[model samples]
Target chain A: MGRLSDRAAFEQYAAQAEQRWETLWSGDRWVISVGISECSIAKGALETYRHLELLLSDGHIPAVLRRVGCAGWCFAEPFVEIKLPGQPPIVYGWVTTDRVPDLLDALRRGELRPEWALGVRAGESWQGIPALRDHPFLRSQRRLLLEQAGIIDPESIDDYIATGGYRAFLKALFEMTPEEVVNEVKTSNLRGRGGAGFPTGIKWESGRRTPAWPKYVVVNSHEGEPNVFKDRRLLETNPHLVLEGLLIGCYALETPHGYNYIGGEHALALRRFQKAVEQAYELGLLGDNILGSGFSCHVRVRTGGGAYICGEGSALMYAIMGQRGQPRTKPPRSVEEGLWKRPTVLNNTETFASIPAIIRNGGSWYAALGTKESTGTKLVTMQGPVRYLGVAEIELGMPMRQLIFEVFGGLRDGYRFKGVQTGGVSAGPLREEELDVPVDFDALTPLGAMLGSGGFVVFDDTVCAVDFARYLVAFSRYESCGKCTPCRLGTPALVEILDRIRHGFGRPEDLDVIQYASKHIIDLSLCGLGQVAPMPLLGMLERFREEFIEHITERRCRAGVCPMTAAAPIAS
Target chain B: MEPTKSGQRVDLEPLRRVLEERFRPRDYREAQELVVGACQEAQRLFGWVPPEAAQLIAEHLGVTTNRIYGLLTFYADFRTEPPGRHFLWICHGAACYVAGAGRLVEFLQERYGITGQGTTPDGALTVHVFNGCLGVCDLAPFAQLDHHEYVGRLNLERLQALIAELQGEAQTEAADGSTE
Candidate 1:
């Protein structure tokens, strides 16, 4: 424990909190935490809260209502979990304001509606519903970063601290040396989850070796990845973990200054993170001489200007320096020469959020969890026809088949899984035959795919591969920073050819042009955005070549998605 | 380069002073920070960075106007022209596309005669130029009215209702011109 007794007091308080769990289950106080998200808010979560408030004012309902982040079951939002004394907490899904009175009445009667009951947790079953973890969607998930999600008040640092939040930082400060911390991370075998899978330990060691005054650490919370929400959810639910990780990185790198670059459009996430920062400062976890350990660090939250390129390391540094969001040429990577021409360390939100756990439990323990190459769990955002639409943290190397069919309950009605796109718009599609592929970075790399930001979307048979290719291609084209010629010109040309192919005007020669443009774009682009610009088109061409040929020869889209520009096929 | 107006030349002191205060420039080394400060101030104060405002920031920070303009243009959030009373952002992410966000975009374009990013002729709304993803993939086909407020699961009827609400609010604001 530190001199302030803060750590000791917190540990005691956490113990007390754990002890109070029995009280919560067997006492008079009833707690209800609604899983709140942008989706839940739109689904009238606020309305439900207001209805509860009205009930409370009427002196009818005798329970406290609290807001929590997404419970990883977004399909069930607005989710509500009710805890009554001496009984298992019953969770309800798809709850609405109109159902509040009935729910409260049932709760008053010590009963729950079976149809609405999703799960119960008290080492007992209720209405045929099993434990929350027993749900197929959550069974295989290894919740590390999201352990406290939908359970704690994110705005309350005391809640976070009482749950053993900053103990890892304290441990890093008092118990271990900076190099020891780096070695521990190395021992954990934690690779960067920021698509690249670079070793976190190596990045830190390099930054440590470089002697520079005022070295910098940056938290890349600018999650502009097309369909990924893991970072946003983590920030919204438990920002302190990320902050702790950033502090750890700072300590390891001996950097005094840090920056958290968040997307400007992420209003809720930004608000929650800002609140956490303020509370951390108030609790002395941040600011000068943090925890009286003589470790001083300052973290500034910089709102990104809504540029996707800013998510790139060098491009992000430029954005922070108030220049155009553009990437720098490599040979001297960001670790050596970064923001303000100083050695800098940058890690994604998920990579940073996992630090506390790695430090608390020995790094070797973490190393033993996942596969040989990729250690620890990965957060994946599942979309498309999956039954459950939410973020889940699963042990890496889990087969995509089990992730989609078993966990997400497979495709929805009238949909057969035709293909799945992992790693956002950049990575190529994996056909149904390739569903058994393990979702680790190295495993997917040989197939011309990467676990790029872990945005996985499943497509049905009805989905036009050509049209979907255009959609992903369009995202890359729109987001390309026009600094480089390959991305600037090549992506547009790719788009033009794709547009023509989709609209039934593609010539036999267009396919050759596409392959040519794609190869050149990957080879000549200045940055990742440009380099990956041709991926969607090329990936679709490689995997779904027949779809393109159908559009060209038959002048008929098998999925009926493309519009016909002319009645007859174009001259060969 | 933009020609300076007489009034702007005479009254550049207010904007210049604000830029200086925002940047806290110790010397020319801190010129880069001024670009962000100027852009943020312009968006917050004037709703857009006019060429004159960029010039003011440039002079105050001891940098060229092109430098400041380069940043404003490069960033998607910054706008050079004034926006209407309200702004709406309809996400076009992969999830949104799968959930029929294209229909919503087409609906907005055909009914309201607005395509991409444009201000309504009535000056009631200015939609962004592109239907960029706003990171709310869970709520596929979600839109942000103003900046912070999210409205999700949008359909034609729901979008019409939202537009009506916006138009009504704008009318009320116009009627009570004294209230900003």
Candidate 2:
């Protein structure tokens, strides 16, 4: 591997190497790839991998087993991709340990199982499985961040390199200076997708400026949003991309240590990440002087106990310090004093995953893709009433209506779209009137919603706003760290009032009580959880007050979704 | 692979070892504390009283099982098995019960083969009659399964269907041999 020390030299090397690399992997070899993403792991892909390893112990097979990330067909996991000489690579899904024997038999006999065959690979096609690409759930997706997912073995550096993995990192570290790297990110205008929407370049610069002995970079992989699986899907499917991004960050900041704070409940992801971290260390990509550069960096994995509040930056810092996962008051922001009192820059998994691409393509190229406010692509986890319910990456400022209808196939069963819940539990619910609103921090914030996290839960006409508000509050309340009075106590009161309202209890004044409490909680809370705790209730109240009034005064739920109100007699 | 004797009690020592190895900068004591917290969380998910779950966690954590067990029993969320496939927790505190939670519970009893505090004959549902504020008072009478909210009023038919749906999913996963 030749090294280039500038962009011009790097471009020349890349141009020459692209042709050479393509020729090398085009040779005859048996490629047996398995989707070992978190969902697949849950379906016992690890055991299947072990079985395959044992079965192929003899050299007669001449096959290499590789573990790739998710392929978006979560409903059918443990997908297997087989590439044999003179045959188009094929992918089979819904695989289990029991099915492995059958799969092996078919492979040996050169027979195909039509039922299991998801699709076929046609010369490096993204949609290896034709059916899967046409599947109602995946047809609308335009994969960018997930480009190499389900294609390359995440743990195998060779597989990653074979698919143009470290090329970006190499170009960034060896060719571009730290200042240039930072400048590219600045030009990209890529704001943080982790709720706050802070500029990534600004954060990097701020942390880089500190006179601290050692700066820290943390990948906030601890996704705790209910009904959201975007981050989880990314980490499960493309662990290496996230790692490469982290490595690029390390190089850009000249930091020595990085931490991936995985959610405690995500056992499968933890296992894969733990293995990936170890593999990175073994390959000398992690510890001490990576790729023969004087720069040295190592990444460690930390598991956070199931605390929703810990998803907040301050609380995440607390958990990393081995404290009870609780939020800390900000003033001495994390960039100044974080993780054992060090200058730390914490960005979400997706945020870090974008870094390598931004570096590879240059900032100007990346910035030109999305809206001015929100640059680059955004990975959104679509859930609930949507038909094509999965994760997809779309350009920022894409229309909410297009995302709901064109991308997610609209409300399931053609149910009228009532509203959409963006940014998970803490995000304010937006009505149909706001459906055309462009997705960006500036637009969403004024509408009393923040692009907290890229999680969109669609609701149909059948959904009851009163009920929905209550559900979110209950989730936030239970997950609260109880570090502050507003979140700890105020939330329960709001829950009680909502319960009363939903159960046909009378009191016009109770609405006033809810309004007062919601305002106070949002204003006085110490952290993001408390600040956003009242969002669901207040949003529902403002947008659908008639429903709440109907549940109380009329003793009936128009949606017929609420139990107490549903049982009430219909008006003549 | 050998099973340790029960009287011997699996130790929490290994948890500390694993934690210390993973968190290199942290000392053994700090590692043990972190492991304890993680174990406590795992116990809550299982809906079991912490002591037994803690012992198992101690084994994973490489610490004395007794030490882990002690920590488990200390937490509020940790529960010993009340024994039910569906952990039906109805909020019966001042807010919920006042807002017709009692009627909802009665409705559940009349419709499904459930009691106030026991599992159904087939172990499909376990209706735990407890009291707590489910936080969304403005909307009241709430119930949850494994901490995931199923809010917005409750009725006999909906409760039955919810239970059946959960049981069906569980059975399907089990039949596929995808779940432990």
Candidate 3:
């Protein structure tokens, strides 16, 4: 068999694999596929999986079962997808142990129950899936980030290969030099997706040129931001892409050790990631002399104990050292002093995933795909009142309105756009007036907001700015690591004042107090947490001062959304 | 491995059995440590771990309840609540206090008719306001529910809605037999 080249090669490989897959199905007389993601496990997907395994072992059914990752419809989990030789692939949602027999029977008869079949897959398009494409929740989505999700069996390396996986890594390793690899990334202008928009190549090159032995590459999957789901989806859907990036990173930085720091509560991501790492190691892709090359590196997976502070680079380093996750005063950053006090290059999963692509295609090619300042694609998790509430990989500097109206299918039904809380809770909210601004780090920063983690939370007119600010403040307060006085104490105090004002107890001077506290915390805090702690509240107060005063003076919430205060005297 | 000062012998057998029977079946090891770790964590959160908590851990770990409880008391992360439906955590830590989480805690006490980790008159909600940091300094003044969903910048009104929503959901789930 000749080596596969491109999409054509993939098609050929898919044809062959399909034939073999068909034979296995027809000869076996039964086949089962289960989505074994974290949420599914919690919902007894594993129990049902075990039950099927037992049935197969008992010779009650001849079947080959495979465990895949999340299909993105988390609301209905433990989703099962079945494909028989002559029958079309069908997906069943909310399957439990009690329903295993029915699923098995369906498999045996090659029958798909309409109630259980959430959708049918037809060459990258879905039908009979509740108007999935036109539905408000999924209307405006360009799913480059989630391209392979819910389609490929995440655990199968073959399935991944069949879908053009590792081609980028192989091309990078076999074809490009380390500096060339770095240059391509530089050209791509891919910034760090983990809140800070630090240019990824600069970080990589700095570590590469550090002249330090035992350099380290760290994958920050600690999605501590409350509203973000980009990294979670990436890890769950295409973990191998992350691993491939990590391997490339290890080669580029000449590092022997790599770690993926996943949040403790992200059970699904951790499971899939661990399996991917183990499989890679088994295939000799992760161990010494990978792909028969002289380069040698190994990857390790570490889990955080659900500390939001650990998402910060320094705090993440501390957590990996098995110590309390607290921020360290930085003169020597992670590029200088990181994990075990080594010169470490830390990039989030999304940032790392871009590297292989940059290497495979030239830097300029990747750069040409996006805007001049911000080159390459950015994975933005669109949430809140937006019609499409999932992750999408968009060209950087894409217009905000396009993302809001076209990509997100506009605001939810019967609601007008109030504003958007971009970059998660840490970012300042962007009002409707600022919606036309291009979505990039610099663009958002100039408007008193920032592109932090690419979490675009849409808000409609019904969302009260005071309550929104309060929600963000409360989130920040709970997630603050308490390493600094300002962040530790100032955030809660600000929340109280905001609460008082929202509850009709606000004095006019309270705004000044909040402003002072916001400035103090931003200036005095030890880490990113404190520095951006008051951003949401301050942003709202700055842009929507009338709303705040309305709550205090008239005891009314202008948006008619603040739960604490009464309606604004019925307008008359 | 040597046992800790608590006089609990380091029994790798139970751990190994659980790991083999449940986790290792799918070629997973060390990956499932979180299951065991969660038990120790629950204990740390609640002080005295409960048998049902251990059973829940076992259910997650794919092991027997007794084995899970043994591992729970053996290690340090499991906990059993005395009697409460709600776990209210107050952030007195630096970030939280700076963000006005203290006042929010006071507000909960004053308005909710429930203080600390006590149940409501209808036993529908239990409030547990503890002192800790949740790591969202930027969105400070936050609190968590059963370590799942986080509510930020809490006030009386938000708290009321949150409690009401939670109670309503709990009732609906009880009616539907859904495990939230």
Among all candidates shown, the one with the greatest lDDT: 1
What are the candidates' C-alpha RMSDs?
4.1, 8.3, 9.6
Model 2 agreement with the true structure over A457-533: per-residue lDDT tens digits: 66666678888788778767766677799888999999898887777774789889988998889998999878888
Ranking by lDDT: 1, 2, 3
- DockQ of every candidate: 0.44, 0.09, 0.07
lDDT of each: 0.79, 0.69, 0.68
Evaluating just chain A, the predictions reach TM-scores of 0.96, 0.86, 0.82
Once fitted onto the true fold, the runs of candidate 2 whose alpha carbons sit more than 4 angstroms away are A1-32, A40-66, A75-84, A90-120, A123-142, A414-416, A565-572, B1-180
Docking class of 1: acceptable
| TM-score of model number 2, chain B | 0.55
Better of 1 and 2 by lDDT: 1
Q: lDDT score, residue B131, model 2?
A: 30
lDDT of 2 by residue, B1-180 (tens): 122323444344544454445433355544554653566444444444335545555555556766555434332233444455556677543234333465666666776644445666555556765433332222335566654444445555566678778778757755776644
> What's the candidate order when arranged by decreasing DockQ?
1, 2, 3
**B78 in model 1: Cα distance from truth in Å?**
2.0
